[model samples]
Target: MLRRANAIAIFHAIRLQPGISQREIGDRTGIDKSTVSAVINQFDALGLLERVADESRKGRGRPSEGVRINGAAGLMLGIDIEPERLVVMSAGLDGVPLDVSEYPALPSESEFAGGVSAAVAAHLARGGSTLAEVRSIGVCLPGLVDRSGKLISSSNFRWGAVDVAGELRARFGQKVWVDNDARGAGLAERLFGCCLDVQDFVFIDSHSGVGGALYLEGAIYAGSLGIAGEIGHTKIVPHGRICQCGDGGCLSAYISGPALRDAFRGAGLVANSFAEMKALAEQNIPEAMGVLDEAGEILGLALSNFINLLNPPNIVIGGGLAVLAPYLMPPAERVLRRHALPEGLAHCTILISELSKEPHARGPLAVALQGLSQLNADGAFPW
Candidate 1:
């Protein structure tokens, strides 16, 4: 029981500060000195935690100094499959990205899942640890994931009714969770980003197609069918172009950059790629500015309704398109001024993810941390 208390206290200490000495940990957690040492040893042996030399004393340490949760000792693999690329990354208890690998676009889930499995296998073969060290695999795909972690449907992938988590369990002999990419990204944000203290908020992902995730009172609020935050398919026009999902007049008709590119091809001011458009936004091109205005307007209109219903104090936008915030954000604020309640919008802090990479980059570490949460004082979850 004391070890259990230490386990809980250790996590609390890490949550407050990612890297702290064992002595400091004992001090903060109020665990007895000898007991803390024993529990830390058990955690280390089980591959649930790692110890690292603190940055301050790079190559130097006292006899019992510089120990941290060994992030690389245990592995959490995260996968994100997009239309143009499949990204697989690993994070350890060190709480830093250990490795990332990618493959060119795949046309099917079998292809994507194969690359994912291969990546996980190769990463484990890197001498980081044996396969036994990996605790779980977390997959973030662009679709609705049922409670059982099955893919119900995806607008972009054309994947339907696949039992992803169960299949993974059968093949890998490891715990696996299938979650909507946007929502999984939001989970990372809640645990590690600016929203750590905000219990109520919305996380919006401005990707090739816009998506969102909702958090109510500090937990993921998956809707009745687990398809909440699928804001992209909502119709914003009466007879606009049809989306890949076979829906008509959806917001994808107007705001999606792909739709914009298809409409304004050969406009002579924009390039044909999202990356190039981002460069143009950086360049402050007038045409680029115009495109963001329309996109932001749609996003803001959708958000205004959400704010009225939820009244969250924060709205975090992450993903590729958010880089155009300077050009796009104003129109969103303007649209909200005319629609949302003044009280709902008052204290809202619209912030961008400050992480160097997109939210997907943080997904693996989030799962690694969740896996760590499973360990009891005995330093193992029941088989």
Candidate 2:
């Protein structure tokens, strides 16, 4: 068991930093050199690692070899099941995406599992790969997902207690992982996106609704019930608009995509969708600008509270909200400057996520990799 843990640690060290030397892996993972060397040798024999010439080697007696995960060793699949669409991505063990596909989601919640399975099969067929080649699968959803991979609920899809990981595991016979979409996105940010070097941060995804994830000490803090970081549910207004979660005065009730669109419609605007509303806001339409300005103030107020509580160095805004950042950030920043604590506001930087386009799809790759790290040589996860 200790050997397996060391091997897994070494594997992750190599995966996170490709072309890392065995000694560097040992140092980074805090494992002894002998164990690192043995694990590297085993991985090389299994064709799971590739040796590369270390360009950083200076005047040495012998050229040091660096190791990286073998791209052809296996594949990982990431599934992002949203209310309106399903996104699937396939990547190599080295974390390079090979292919990505998007499909419309089934309207009925009961058919979601079958739909997802069919989509996976189709994706594999399109990529000329089989399920047998997949090392693991990761799934993310816009809902409250328990640590055991059970989705407690999704207001968008009206789902309840779906065993997402078990369903996928039974269908494909591969190790499966599941988590909330925002948490998945946060993991992706840490692993591959803007927050790679950041250990503590807050990630907010604003699409159909707002969602948040907290990352502290280089790991996600899922909280006691595994449903922490529900920032959208934080009350912004007393006796305000009703939210989809059957709550009143939630932050999402005022700033979510539907809410913003509804706000525009109520003001006699011609906006049909969130994108159209953004276009109107871009055109300097007074009504649209006013609506966004109000929303931004509300959002900032909520962020100020978060900053005071968590004091995160970085707060990333992603999802559809990223597209509208240019218009919203100015007012939000002003509010933060006015309301937030001087120390916390001064230290925190709000960033627009570059992974906004497909974070949900990309994020599951991180989940899959994390799950892979727990498996032993015989493919059983002891924990």
TM-score of 2: 0.90
lDDT of 1: 0.67
* TM-score for candidate 1: 0.79
lDDT (10s digit) by residue, model 1, range 250-294: 776655656656544534564665566667777777777677677
lDDT tens digits, residues 1-383, model 2? 67766765677788878888888887887899987888788778766788997656746768899998998899989888888789899999877898999888866667777998899999999999988899878888888887777788887677777877777777876578888888888878877789867878999877777899998765678876788888888998989899988989999898888788789988889775556877999899899999888988988898899899989899988776777787788898899999899999989988888887653457788777766665453433322
TM-score per prediction, in order, is 0.79, 0.90
Collision pairs in model 1 = 50-68, 50-69, 50-70, 51-68, 51-70, 52-68, 71-92, 71-93, 71-94
Candidate with best TM-score: 2
Off by over 4 Å in 2: 1-12, 28-47, 270-274, 358-360, 376-383
Every candidate's lDDT: 0.67, 0.81
The candidate maximizing lDDT is: 2
Candidate 2 global CA lDDT score: 0.81
User: How large is the C-alpha RMSD of every model relative to the true structure?
Assistant: 5.5, 3.0
